[model samples]
Target: MAILIDENSKVVVQGITGREGQFHALRNRDYGTKIVAGTRPGKGGEQVESIPIFNTVQEAIDETGANVALTFVPPAFAKDAVLEAAYADCQLIVCITEGIPAKDEAEMYNLIKNNTKSKLLGPNCPGLISPGKSNVGIMPHEITLPGNVGVVSRSGTLTYQAVHELTQLNIGQSTCIGIGGDPVPGMSFIDILKEYQEDEETNAIVMIGEIGGTAEEEAAEYIKNNITKPVVSYIAGVTAPPGKKMGHAGAIVSGNKGTAKAKMEALEEAGVLVVSNPTKIGKAVKEVI
Candidate 1:
């Protein structure tokens, strides 16, 4: 079973009238996601791709019994969209918009921290897919399949690259989560790791990390103490120069901290098999599993 979503999830689009929202809403619905309703301020009472639109999230939830909300609103309005979803009692909210201010993200996170029933995915992420069952975000659904491997990553394109390699080697995944490369993303590597550890369908895990933050290092420590499943990890940006931001907003090296070598060393110490090369991710997983 998937962690955050599955075949039974009733989803709603928060910015359904916009170009990106309409496009992905149709794609996700075609992939078998139960998209029950959508929200667009002045476009209420209209329909896009046959899904009814509402002026507010509460109205959409009240009318459609929507438990999941996907936000494609612009970055400036993303925080309010997320808050509206949370207040409307959407159990799971996935914000696909990128470039949201860090302070806004922090505030949105704080608003939902005490709401035990709600969970957020990303503000600059590709979202997660439980292959063969449901596709939530913009990840190419055609490349994934149902299997025993669970994959989680901080980078979106890198997550796709690793999944492609695994698929080529006939290593299908139970769930693949792109947790966003922002400094203060909604979910942490350890959070996804714990879910995978408890999932009976998952046999092994692949973690893809990049240089910049100590998230990988912290995850390694958690694995050393609590995880039992075999894990293979890949840390990107080994050749990145110090103090320069990489593609991700969070990917920056500061002196000796947050370096690729440092993260790899920590993972190795935690008994995780670390791969230095991206193309070798699948090979490393095969060796471990």
Candidate 2:
């Protein structure tokens, strides 16, 4: 039982007419996603990649019964796209668009909680995928393998790196979720941790996190008290100078909180195996097993 999405899921691409949107839609379709419709305002009654297009999410859902939405809407209108999907009753909304304002995400989160019961994966996320099942975002499916270990990360590329390394060790993953590299994301480490903890197929977990967020600490606390699965973590931005930001826009540390050291301490204290080097992630997981 993979979390969020699998092979049977149906998806609608919001802003499917755009170049990026079309590109990913084609890629997702080729990857075996059940892409039934697309949403692009004023471009209704057309088709992209053979999937029907509509002016709004409501129309797309009404006509095609799409339960999942993968958003490629630009940063400025990304909030509206999410709200539209929520209104259309999409069970899961995966926002692949980046740079959405924090305030807008707060509003979108509120809307999801208040008006709709839909689970939002990200406002600035890579969405999600279950290898050999379904993929909705930008992850290349060829590198993934299906197995017992579950993975979740804040960085997209790091997620792949962890999965690739695990594969080299002949350790396939049940699922790999990239929750996004944003200051505020819809799905936190806690959220994914809870899902992974309950998922029967996931016997162990690997969390790939980076600097500049208290999310890892929060997940550490949860793992210490709640989760029973073997957990391994890798914290990026270790070599980053104090009070200095890293490459990713969300990679910034100021006070005592949100440092790689602080997160590592919390994770270590919580009984999570912490890796000191990025390249040693697979070896560390190997040690845990």
Candidate 3:
């Protein structure tokens, strides 16, 4: 019982003809995801890896009953692809394109909020994986195994690193979600946390956050008030200089706000076992569990 997707999800690729789209589509298919159809305007009737292609998302959904849309469109055209998927009523829309203008994300977010039932994952994210069940975006498939741990992270590589470490330690995960490092990403830590809290299959949780935004702080509050499961956290950018932007788009330290220390302190106060070092994430979770 994974959140967002499972074995029953029929997926459609929005930019199926492009290099990234086709590449990940094949990888996802090989990982046992149900790749039902794809959409490529002017390339309809053509196929990639034997998957049928349609000109529009509506046509693809109507023909294939695809409920999940994986988008690999360019930054400039990402919003339109997302809007098309939302308008097509795709239940889960995962956008892997990065560098989209913040305003465009905000606009698309509001449009989805007011008009559709679509739940968007990322505009600059690694996407989610339900190990041994389904793979959605760009994360490596072999690093995860099915277990009771639930992972949610804002950084893609960090998500992978943590999952790899957990797998190495024989602590498999129920779901691993990368919520993206964009300022206005589709999903939040609290959103994923709530889902994990309610999921019967999940026994523990691992939260990977970075310096920047009050997201981790808000999630800490929610955990303090609501969650009872064991939680271990790792916050990056502890050694980062203030007022400087790090690798991720949202990873910047400002004056007295969004600091790694502050986030770590908040999690600590919330009864979360906070790991100061990234490499020790798996060990920390093991201790808590």
Candidate 4:
């Protein structure tokens, strides 16, 4: 029982007529996701890769009984797409679009909180994959394999790197979730950590976190008190000059609360294995076993 998605999940593709949407939807279908319906505004009668397209998410859900949604809408309309999915009662909404305005995200966040029962994965993320089950996001299929460890991360490329190293070590994962680097997306490190801790197939966990935010600290607190599974974590942004911005704007550590050093210290004190080198993640995880 990995988090968010599993084999029984039936998915709908939002913005199905667009090139990106159609391509990934077909790919997801091929990857064993039950992609049963699609949404494309006025192209309601069209069929994309044999899946029926509808004018609204409600229409698609009604026709296909799709409980999950994979959205490929443009950034400008991404919030609207998510809201539509949430309102349609899609149990899981995976938003693959990046670069959503903060204000738009706030409104969407509030909408999801107040009105929708749907659980959101990401607005700027690679999405989640449960091995031998379903993959509904943009991550490459070849990198993952079924195993005992569950992977959760904020950085997309860094998540890939961790998976690659783990696969090389022949320790594949039960599920991997790229919760995204965005400030206001759905899932956080603590959220995924709770899910991973509850997952029976997952014997261990690997968390890839960036240098900013109090997220890692919060996760460390959770680990100290609740998480029982062996956890190995890597925090990025070690080389960035103090007070300078780096890759993701949200990755800058300001004030006393959100530095890489501080986060690592917290995790280490919690009895969580915190690795200094990103390249050594697999080896670090192996030590726990």
lDDT of each: 0.90, 0.88, 0.93, 0.88
| Best-performing candidate as measured by lDDT | 3
Steric overlap count per candidate: 0, 0, 0, 0
State the lDDT of candidate 1 residue by residue for 156-267, as single tens digits: 9999999999998999999999999887888889989999999988999999999998999999999999899999999999998898878777998987779999999999
lDDT tens digits by residue: candidate 2, 221-258: 99999999999999998878877656566788978788
Q: Give the range where candidate 4 is weakest over 10 consecutive residues by summed lDDT.
A: 240-249
* Stretches of model 4 off by over 4 angstroms after superposition: none
For residues 186-248, write the lDDT of model 3, one tens digit per residue.
Answer: 878998999999998999999999999899999999999999999999999888899887867
> Which lDDT value does model 4 have at 287?
95
Clashes of 2: 0
Model 2: weakest 10-residue lDDT segment is: 242-251
> Cα miss at 7, model 4 (Å)?
1.1
- Whole-structure CA lDDT of model 4: 0.88
- Local lDDT at 152 for model 2: 95
Q: Which of candidates 1 and 2 is the stronger one according to lDDT?
A: 1
Model 2 misplaced stretches (Cα beyond 4 Å) = 247-249
Query: Residue 22 error for model 4, in Å?
Result: 1.6
For candidate 4, report its TM-score: 0.96
TM-score of each: 0.97, 0.96, 0.98, 0.96
